[model samples]
Every structure is written in C-alpha cells, then in structure tokens.
Target: MVVKMNLKHVDELSGGRKRFRRRYPKSLVPVLGEAVFQVAMKAREGGALVSEWESLMKTYDRNVAKAERAAGVAGADDRLSPLELWREARRDAAAMLAAFKDDLTEDERRELLGDELERREADPVLYRAVVEPDAPEPKPTLLDAKNMYLQERLEGGTGRNNKNRLDRVCKRIEATLGPLNKLSLVDLTRDQARTLRDAMLSTRKADGTRLAPASVRRELDMIKAMVSLGIKEFGLQREADNPFIDLPISSKGVAPDVDSSKRDPLPKNVLLAMRDRMREKAQVPALGLIWRLLEGTGCRGAEVVGLRREDVVLDGLYPHINVAWHEDRRVKTKASIRSVPLVGDALVAAREALTLSEGEPMLFPKYARENGPDAASAALMKHLRTVTKNPRHVVYSLRHNMKDWLVLAGTSERVENRIMGHTVGGLGDRVYGGNDAKLKVAYEAMEKAIKGMP
Candidate 1:
C-alpha cells in the first residue's frame, strides 16, 4: 500500500487552527505551523498526479531548511532565505528523482542517494536525520491525538451529550486496553477494540446486572469511531477493512432489548392525587407548574426546563410552548422540535411560572440557572417519586398518560402526534400543517382530563 501526501499550509484552510485530518489510503495533509512560505496554497495536491517522487519534497525541503539554517548557508542572493534555497533544491531533486526512477525499490532509492548521502554525511547531523532515511516522523500518542480531535470537535459543533459520550467511550476503552496516554497508535487495533466490546458486554451498573444491549451497542459504536480515527491519524496500512467497521452488536443470546415499557401512564386516580397535592404546595410552586405543563403538553421534562420566557406564546390563538433546540440543550429528535399546545393545568402553570419568572430569561429559573433539563429532571423526579410512592409512576409517566388521554379523547392520530412532538407516521401530516383547529381540540381535551382532580 502506498501512502500519499496532501500537504497544505495551515492558513490555506478557512479557519486558522483546526488541525488538518485526513483518512484512508494514506493521504498526507500538513498540520505544520504558520510560516511566511505556505506551499500548498498554490500547488494543491489534488490538482494533478505528477510523479510519486514529488511526495518527498516537503520533507526534503523542511530538512534542507533546518540543515541550511544550522550551517548558515546564506547565498549571495538576499531575496531568498535558507528555507527558500531548500525549496528550490527539493523541486530540482524531485524532477531528477522522477527522471531517474519510476518505481524504485528501497535499495534502488538508497543507491541513488549514495553520493548525496556522502556529501551530506560530512555533517553528521544532516546526514543521519535526512539524506539517509531510517528515522520515522514523530507520532502523537493515542491520548494526545484523541484530545486534539475531541477538543476541536466539542468546542463548537457536536451536541454536549454526544461530546460527553465520545469522551466516556475513549476512557472506558482505555481502561480495557490499558493506559491510553502511554499506548502507541499501534495499540489501537481490531483485537484491542474487540476487548473493549467484550468488556462493555460484561459491564454492570450498581446492582451487578450485565449492561443493557443498547448501552453495549453505544460503547461499541464509539469504540469503533475512536479506533478508526487513530488508524487514519497514524497512517496505518492494512489489507483488511478497518477493525472497528463491522463488529456485530450482540444480545448475548437473550433479548437485551430496552424496556420501552418503563414510562407507563399514570392511573387516573394516582394522577389526580399528585396534581391536587402538588398544585397547592408552597414548598415548590414551580414544581407543580412544571408537572402540569408536562401533563398538559406531553412534552419531555428537558423541553420544559429549557423553555425561555420568550418561547411561551400566550397571546397566540392557541397558547403553546416551543420545544425547539438551543445551544445549551438539544431535543431527543428533529420531531421533538414542534410546539405543544399549553392546555389545562399546563396553561395555568405556564402563566404563573411566567409571572414568577418575569425578570429572568427562563420560565423555570431554578433548573436553568443550574443547567437545563437533566438537573431539572433529577430534582423533580426525586420529589415526585417520594410523593407518588409508586416505583414505575414517575414524572415521565405524565407524558405517557398524555398519549393515552389524547387517544381516549377521540383526537386524530395526526394531531395527537403533533401535540406530543412525535413524527406523524404519514407524509400528509406535513402537507397539511399543525393548524390552530387541531391545537384547540387537543388543548380542550387536555384541560378536561386534568380537571378531573377536585
């Protein structure tokens, strides 16, 4: 397998300091520092394939620049730096090498360099490091490379939870493979990656049960990503497909499928007790309001927590809350990015929460002040579970109940999904939008359902 160089001066790219990353069949894109002379700015690699020998010019020129500067080989011409002379010499060397040998073996190439080696050998520093070609370029460790990739990755583009997941997989894989910072790029291999998957499969949470299928699958996928990146960054050449590419996600013979039945709907009696109990409490009025919104809208807790005062549309024909994505918080899916009509206790809660949080940006200032959604869920769930005194009946059960409520109310499946921020299975749902009429109907139904309390 032949490794190719796709050299570019760092500045030629749009952003100033995004590390240049290339993948597969070994293309060399430069991660070299800022300089007065940027080579690939003009002579781009993708333009034409001149000759294989040209690949060495960047290395050769860099070596020449180092050697010339050390020996102070300033020419009579002041226009050129020592680096400039190195550049010209590398171009000439590339042409001669192209003419002399089309596909020379290592021995042939070394023989061609015999005289040049002798000339440069006069200076031990230049000859051993360059002209003679045994020394490999400095390689970054697995941790260093992963750090560079993730730092650039997480700072702007990736979702926060995803960024955290990537970090977690690397750490867990490292635990399985041994210390990552000390490990060579070669340590990241198919066998080592298999070890990670095995470890994940055997992994357990506090109760000592084996990891869920979904958890193992996520870890395996992330491991694959890390191993593939390491291979590309290190420029490893192999005959087989990437080790991480096709690992089977196993269920270990049993159905390790996720129990989607976890968030069961609240029974009508239990919900009424919770609503009536929470609503009048002064200890956490915000909690009651938020619970009602979740009940009313069938939206996730995170969506409710991340809601800003500006997003609540009370004046609109159908008062609703926006479940949109924000920089700080992301919804579960694209379908989670719709408005849910605020009805019943939800409308009352939204208005009161708005009044309490008038000066603040977020509707729920406490949860958001700490960090949106997840923190809010934890706080509310603990208290909610204590009061409800039922193991399965928790805060998310409100959302589940909303679905059942809508079905019972005779609302169309389309409007039910729209209100719940779910994908309306049919394409026509999009052709005819989520109109005010549907929202009004859903709101009326939700209002009736929650008012069953007193």
Candidate 2:
C-alpha cells in the first residue's frame, strides 16, 4: 500500500523512506547539469520530512531561476560567427567536463574516459572537430571587453556612480561605433576615434548648447582607458596602435567657447561670503558643517559628505577624518585614501556634526545612501549660486582654493600633496615615510593653510 505525504514531488518508497524528485526544464538542463534532481529523506517524522522537502524545493527553484537568467544573458548562439560559436562551445564543454570530473569517483572517471576514447576512435574526425579543432580563438568584441573590464574593476570596490558613468560611456561609444556585439576591439581604428570625437563635440543638449571640450575630453579619456584595459587584458593590440589614445579634439568645426568652460578657484572674499550666507540661511545644519569641512580640509565633496561616525577621530592626538573606502562610498584613487587633519573651522564643524549625528552610524545619515553625495553637492551648488554668479566657481573649486592657500603658506609640495590627498612624488616619497610621519607633516601644512586662509 502507498502512503500519501500530501506534499508534491515527495513519494513514499517501499522501505518506508520518502524521496523528493523534480525535473528541470528542458531549456535549463544544460545549465543545471541534470534533467532531474532527487534526494532521499531519512526523517520519518511528518514535520521533519515536510521541512526537508520544502528546503529542497527552494534550492531547486533558486537554481532554475539563476540558470534562466544566465541563459537569457547568453541568448541563442545561432547568430554568432563561426569563431565566436567555437569559443562558446569550448567554454561550455570545459565547464561541463570540470563539473563531471568533480562529481565522479576515480573508477567512474576512468570508465567515462574509456568510453569517450572508444567513441573518439570510432569517429576521429568528428571528435577532433568537436573537442580539439585547431582554430584561432575569436577576438573579443567591444561588449565582451566592457564586461571583462567592469567585472575586474567592480571587484576592486568601485562605487555605483563610477559604474554608471562607465555604462553611459559604453552606450555613447556604441551609438557612434555601432552595436558593441558586432564591433571587435581589434577592428577599432584612428579614423573611427576621430569621428567619435567630432560627433561628441557636435552633439547638443536639449538647451541647444554644444558639448564642452572638457566633457568630451573626459569621455574620450574613459574610452582610452577602456581600450587600454581591453588591449592589455586580451593582448588584442599594442599601446602604440590604440585608436583612442591621444586623439585630439579638433576645434575647426566647434564653437569657440566650448573649451573655455572650466571651474576656477573660489576667491577668498567669495568663500567668506558663502560661509556667512550658509550660516544665516542654510536649511540643513549638517550641510553647512559639511561645507565648512570641505573648505577647511580641501577634500572632495563626496569624501566629506560620505563620512561615517567611526571615520571621524576627534579624540586622537591629531584630530582628523580618515578618508577610506567603505561599502557606502569609495575613495577616488589609492592616493585619495589618507587622513585629513581637522584644523580651524573644520575641527569645530566636525565636532558639531558629530553632536548632531546623535549616535547614528553615518555622520550625515540623510546623505549616506547611494548617490547621497551627489544630492549634497546639488544642494551646496544652489547655495553657492547666491554667493557668486561666475559659472566657473563650483563646489570643487574649494579644493583648488585650498591648494592656493597651502602654496601661499610656504608649505612644501610634498606636504601639500599629503594635506590634499594628491599623489605624492616618486616611490622614495611613498616608501620612506610611515603613517605617523605623514600625518604630522599633513597636520602642520593644513594648520598653516587654515591660518593663512583669507
């Protein structure tokens, strides 16, 4: 007699044991590596058996969903070129072989190899074509290069904005060069690079204003970096033949004022005026404090706004903020990871901001989420507009202003570099000093700059 457990896919076996069995979808069989999944349930208790069955069901569902997503990404291989098809087949075959090897015992492995050898001997030509054809590997397309670049870069903890920017750059590049899937990296040419440069310059926004040379330059720089990465990673091309490298933005057909747009350092008087205005009318108390921190420390806006409570070390011998990478935010570069001494107004602001934090994890809780720093910047820019009408005077200009302050204070370039988180001199400069020595020098330079601030 058969007993019913009332659970789907769970069956009572002859020896009073229950088993769970489910078949994978036909399309997903290759991805899941099996047509059916089965496991024996040793527990006879109803609750335990149900729990085991449910757990197995969840695992099956998750595997199926994951396989479906991967299959979607891969799409049909019918449209692929012969070389691309061969590469895909080779990768899939290798993955299947590895998985098969992992699951089998030594005896089973030997049996499998012997059977495969007999089949190979029966049809040598077909075996060679399927398993070991002597064809050159397919060159990676632009899309493939982009995927590989992003995979490696994102693994190193790049932030969301940077990833978004790379995506935008790739989209723009695709628009000019053609679909990335069809455009092989090896086929990219200098003429195409020039055309892309010219296209970006001529492109206009909804307001009918042409793209700035600086903006175009930044996009081109991104392209160059991507191509450079692709070339190095895949051995596709040499540095000398990189199409995107040193492609000058010709001004022959562009408007005269496109290149003139740039951020200028905020004058001392304007900086003071803005500080006073923020004091009187700023809505967010934390924003005002963030501004003062930026003014005093000369840090990037994101660095100041994205600070966590733990990053602010006011109790140390040198009260400073640790600018480092966290899950919520990423520093600009390796050099950007440094301790910034809190001097003058910055110290007062940090203390006040800490008090206002009220034991929250982030110093500025409202601006600690994704794209939080960007929001803070927009709000600060609104306030900055009231103080100065100059289009060039931006939030970043405060950093430039601090550089000038350090210069006027007679600080050495190395000291200023430490204070501002810029890349220090050569290898000797980096290797010779410990963190303590670097912090001491940075503190002195920052103190001088703050004191000398007009």
Best by lDDT: 2
- Clashing residue pairs found in predicted model 1: 6-28
> Which regions of candidate 2 fall more than 4 Å away from where they truly are?
1-139, 154-161, 201-217, 231-242, 245-261
Q: Rate residue 348 of model 2 by lDDT.
A: 95
Question: TM-score of each candidate?
Answer: 0.61, 0.64
**Candidate 1: RMSD over Cα atoms?**
14.4
The sequence of per-residue lDDT tens digits that candidate 1 reaches over residues 357-449 is 878766776665323455556667766665667777778887777777777777677767777888878666665754676668766665655
Q: Write the per-residue lDDT of candidate 2 for residues 255-322, one digit (tens) a residue.
A: 55532246788887898898998899998998899899999999999999878888999886788999
RMSD of 2: 12.3
